[model samples]
Target: MKAIVIETVKPGGYSIINADDPLVLSVQEGARGETIMFSLDPDNPSLKDNLKKGNMNVTCRDENIIIQKGGWTSIVAKVNEIPITYNGKAPFNIQNAMAAVAATSALGLNEKQIRAGLVSFSPSIGLSPGRMNVIDLDYFKAVIDYGHNPGAIKATGELLPHLSVGRKLRMAAGTGNRRDEDIIEFGVILSRYYDHVVVTETDPRGRPIGVVANLVKQGLLKGGLSEKQISMISDVRVATDTILNMARKGDLVVLQADDVHFIIEYVMEYKNIKKRQLSKEVVNDDHSKEGGQNAG
Candidate 1:
């Protein structure tokens, strides 16, 4: 799939690619014309070789997203100014941004325009739904994501340490259409990153109702997580709410369900309910003080 695109666009076409990944870079072979490569490391061998040949390249240099085409170069924006990258703490998001820079650069947008677009883009329901949508409840936090594959799991795992330090809980589901080994691998990989794992509802395909969830649970246990830290909830909504309530102050809950949009909506509504509860508590405290003073 990767090589096919590169091969087809080989003639007089721009193939914006990620040079940091060797597996992906190998597809660049036999490609004719310009291939704009992007990388987090300015000194990456692929980026360097591309630049040595005067091919277009995008890289983060000196904490800035830098673009160099032959001899001319420009700095589009600083790493800290981009919110989607978690102020540059998320390596995966940063790499994604670099790819975006490569694409925009190919589109002939000047640095100024790209800078404006990058800064304004954020993860929101209206803008980017189901892609790392954060829900803050003024205490603990939760995020809704749509990534289901092992690679996506690993990338999110890479971003875990940079997230709010607290008890990390993940609410996940496995699709029956996926291979059993793939489902197990998904759980095993997540076990390395999260404190607790909630196996939620999934598409049964042809498998039994609980078969897929149990497989993930088996992987979680195999990955060294104890039975005490795992739960098999067959309903996505119930699993989400249960996990949220289980979390204490400052804890982090990551939600990955089949219906990402529904999860986001439910979590947001849950956040609003918590907000109202906090407000009522504050009002009650103020009224208690007033009544005590009046009695005195």
Candidate 2:
């Protein structure tokens, strides 16, 4: 059995320390001498040379990762066909899909099975909780992800422009246990990407109340985000409600939190109430029109 290794991802490049990272080394050693390597297009020479010396197969040089083995080359699946990649708008997910396809191919799954699996797969709260779970409502869109660190936040930011959101809102908080500097870094990244931000508190881990929230606010201010663009609400539920209330049609809200189930339930209830109100308004308008016609 051959193990596939993803050597790099878009926007951020290599996520690990380097190609020779301990995890990479351990995987390479434990694969029973069979391994498959995936690298970014235009191929990293060092990684290519290393894998070549180890007699491992490699995929390189294309938007659709091309895998080669025994003088045969083939693509696993088109990026647009995979729902998780959002039609290739999400580059990170493209890499992920490619990695999955590579592994399945190594396991002797035919192209038809691999393609069928990729197209049928969908990413949602139920399927992949806290990992880019997106919910689209009639009026707006919401993304709930477990993006806590600076790098993760940056990656999330890269996906914003692709969403075609009119106004971006972020529901964010700092963990009580993280360093103040790191918490501030989160704000700085948010300031760069979001149009409006609501800062709140999570479990707090162990830090005093208001400590982490204040630090995040300070970072937003330092990043040149006006106080008008920022709002501080300590309660998670209230903060979620406030941000949703602020959102308008075609807007996007990204919530970085520990639990998104409550927020999702709240949004569903809000949408139901809106639907009922809209139905009543339509009925009233029709009645008024009928009465006017009868009087005339």
**Winner by TM-score:** 1
Worst window of 10 by summed lDDT in candidate 1? 2-11
lDDT values, one for every candidate: 0.85, 0.73
Candidate 2: segments with Cα more than 4 A from true spot: 1-35, 54-62, 106-108
What TM-score, to 2 decimals, does candidate 2 have?
0.82
The residue-by-residue lDDT of candidate 2 on 1-296, one tens digit each, is 22342332234222221232345545454333244555444255645655555532334344455555554666666677788888778766766666676567666787788888888888777777777877776688878888778877887789888885589999999878888898888788789989999999986788888999999998898888999999999998899889988989999988885776776677668778878988999999999999999999
**Best candidate, lDDT:** 1
lDDT of 1 by residue, 13-65 (tens): 68888877888877778565688889888888888788888888889888999
TM-score list, all predictions: 0.92, 0.82
**Model 1 has how many clashing residue pairs?**
0
Global lDDT for candidate 1? 0.85
Model 1 TM-score (2 dp): 0.92
